[model samples]
Target: MLAAATAAVLLLFLVALVMMAAAAFAFAVLMLMAVP
Candidate 1:
């Protein structure tokens, strides 16, 4: 039971990390387009 909970938490962390990375990438693209 503990292992399963740990796994779920890890998965959630990974998803959050990916989302943050995607947001950063999108922001960078928008800045590039605005500047040029």
Candidate 2:
């Protein structure tokens, strides 16, 4: 049971990390477009 809970937490953390990375990438693209 403990292992399962830990796994769930890890999965959530990974998803959050990916989302943050994607958001950062999108923001960078938008900034580039606006500047040029």
Candidate 3:
């Protein structure tokens, strides 16, 4: 039970990290387009 809980938490963390990275990448693209 403890292992399952830990796995769930780790999975959630990884998903959040991926989402943040994708957001950053998109923001960078937008900034580059706006510059010129």
Identify the leading candidate in terms of TM-score. Answer: 3
- Estimate the overall C-alpha local distance difference test score of candidate 3: 1.00
- Model 1 weakest 10-residue run by lDDT: 27-36
Q: Top lDDT: which candidate number?
A: 3
Relative to the true structure, how large is the alpha-carbon lDDT of every model?
0.99, 0.99, 1.00
Model 2: colliding residue pairs: none
Once model 1 is optimally superposed onto the true structure by TM-score, how far is the C-alpha of residue 35 displaced, in angstroms?
Answer: 0.3
Question: Can you give the lDDT of residue 7 in candidate 3?
Answer: 100
* Residue-level lDDT tens digits of model 2 in 1-36: 999999999999999999999999999999999996
Off by over 4 Å in 3: none
Q: What would the TM-scores of all predictions be?
A: 0.96, 0.96, 0.98
Off by over 4 Å in 2: none
Off by over 4 Å in 1: none
